[model samples]
Target: MNKDFHYFGTYSAAILAGHSHEDALRIARSAFFVDLCTQPVLNSVGAPIEAATTMLAMEMADARSDIISQQDVTRTWASFHFLPYDLYSERKGCGKKYMQKYRLICKPNGDLLVDTVTQVKGKSLEATGLAMHVLADTWAHQNFAGTPSRVINDTNYHFFEILPDGSERRISLRPNPASPDDLIKGLFTGTMRQGKETSVMNLGHGRAGHLPDYSCMRYRYLPAWADYEEVIKDNPSDFMHAYCQMIYAMKYLKGEGGTFEKATYDTETVAPYKEKIEAIFEKRQTDDSEDWKAFGESLSGQEIPDFDTPDYLEEYHKAPEDKKDDTPMGRFILAALAQKSMVTNRVYKSGNILLGISGDYKDWGTKGIRAYLKLAKEVRKGGVI
Candidate 1:
């Protein structure tokens, strides 16, 4: 999901789940920062490069598709963005090699989702926010893997958008990442296809374009891994579920529920506002930040401030080194480190070397690997990611 869902929509869910306005902003901001907290962004903010939870487009585009780079990409993208639901998920008659990529396909309610939420229980709001981002994505990014694999991630011309009237509109895609999807003309923009089996072009939903990012979109397309079968993505439904589930998960984080579980939603709490929420989803727009921000304000009787990526940069820079980790940005960095560690450890434990081996930093240690060692020091100190 984009900032609309990860930021404002998350704030809406947190408010509905009983978080105070101040607390909700922290959660929502951290959720959005999962995308913004990249190496370049963190460097500019004067943060340790080890704290970046994502990669900039230039970094990703220039990254090699070799095995080592693939592992690095998987560590960042899989941990933060397209979190794999189950590392051991199976496909009938599939061999071990193909299963590696298959296991990375994201779906909601998997064990990793449970680990993601429960790990942050009673932790910082930033951790809760980071978990919310991963949880919301399981709904939006379902059926896609985090790693680069052409056979598993490629798409053909069999794309169609399911309109509100239950009709289908054929989608014509062109390679133009500079512009947004032209829904009015049924034209979309996506990455140009690359024949290389592990090109970054084949990663995530790039092949499907931003259709998966917009909550108002629902489409039918043939997945490269689905053996020519058609899968219909009812995004309004999925996005709605994501919002409700975020509330449920947030409630658990707020000490309401006993434990966080998959497939549960706080539909009861959101029922009264369901109509308005549905309206936002049914509007068929590329972005819904304004609608979500308005609703969040209504929920708490306070303005939902614009998300400034560097909002906490000054705090980090001015604080004493010993107290730097006490700032919101510091907490966010720690949470990012923790979440990435937990997910990477899980991937390694599941016997999928596609993301490489996971080991204790105490036992081993990168900008190449030294930078990773430095990050591991944070995780070792905190006792998680």
Candidate 2:
């Protein structure tokens, strides 16, 4: 068999199986990253940049992948908790707690690689999804630091002040999985508010209020919904882009944004998913301008944009209140549509999407192979076009 003939199948089949192109790409990209870290491969600065593009491209694909149902999203989110520590680990300085949270390792080079820890303690799926989000953030930070960097401090996590009416409103960062963007509000330009009911900050904070020594670190808990809306007001385009990606990604696979028929576990699910699919079929005879136009445009493909900006990213700032409810589906649709151009442009710039899979990489070609396979699946499933 020819070495190049490693893959054999129709792209559509992959899609029907319910996997996204981006997920496939990420598996491949991850393989390449692993190889580079393991093998003594020489590389240029362009290599890492290209690798970064592949990472984001796969993410875009995942963000747009089809969701057959909200349950699917929930299950997938849960499954992430099982991801092995070795797959995405990094070392931290010194602490005995949260050891399973992640692992520490040394690369072939002197750079320390912190692996992403995805398992949720006590087998909680909701906790797992939250864990994945935190891990994504941690990976983003570690990747940027690139070498001999700590992923988290065993004793360190974020703290937020829930008292909005009192003087105790504040959010604290301890440097482990600590991102300035996470700590501060870019748009509000002041301290972040911790919502009374839903604290977005707490989603990342993990083990909070439970800490016996709560006063050890100060916390300002902002209203989750308010902060969410404020995020939109502060940067309508960016918030729209972010939420759009999440919604559309769920919708692409499930045929509706995966909000549930009713709220379960205190969260919204996709009644919209079922309704939108029905509406699409029901409205079929009545002139299909909006969706048809969008579908037609999607064939061209484009890339999703990054939402974090310098201001929102700065330490200890808040976003404005008006940003939450602006232009719902439109934002997501535009972001997903951008994939066509982004992928194509990057491919043209480099010879292939596997720009990061270079230097002493032979077997690791599977990384690229798997990525394309994932892409083919997504495209065929109608989650991506």
How much RMSD separates candidate 1 from the native structure? 2.2
Q: How close is candidate 2 to the true structure, as a TM-score?
A: 0.19
TM for every model, in the order presented, reads 0.94, 0.19
Using lDDT, give the best candidate's number: 1
- Model 2, 200-296: lDDT tens per residue? 1221122222111111122333322122221101111221122222232222224433432211121132232333323422331222234323322
Which residue segments of model 1 deviate by more than 4 Å?
361-385
Q: How close is candidate 1 to the true structure, as a TM-score?
A: 0.94
Which one wins on TM-score? 1
- Residues 1-385, candidate 1, lDDT per residue (tens digit)? 7888899999989999999999999999899988888888778767777667788889888998678888888888888778887777678998988888988887888898899999888789989999999989989988888888888778888988888888987887788877777677777888789998888888888888888888889899999998889999988899999899999998998899687776898899989999999998877778899998888899999999998765577788788977877888888887877777778888888888887777766565432555455456665666764
Q: Where's the lowest-lDDT run of ten residues in candidate 2?
A: 1-10
* Candidate 2 wrongly placed segments (more than 4 Å): 1-160, 169-245, 253-385
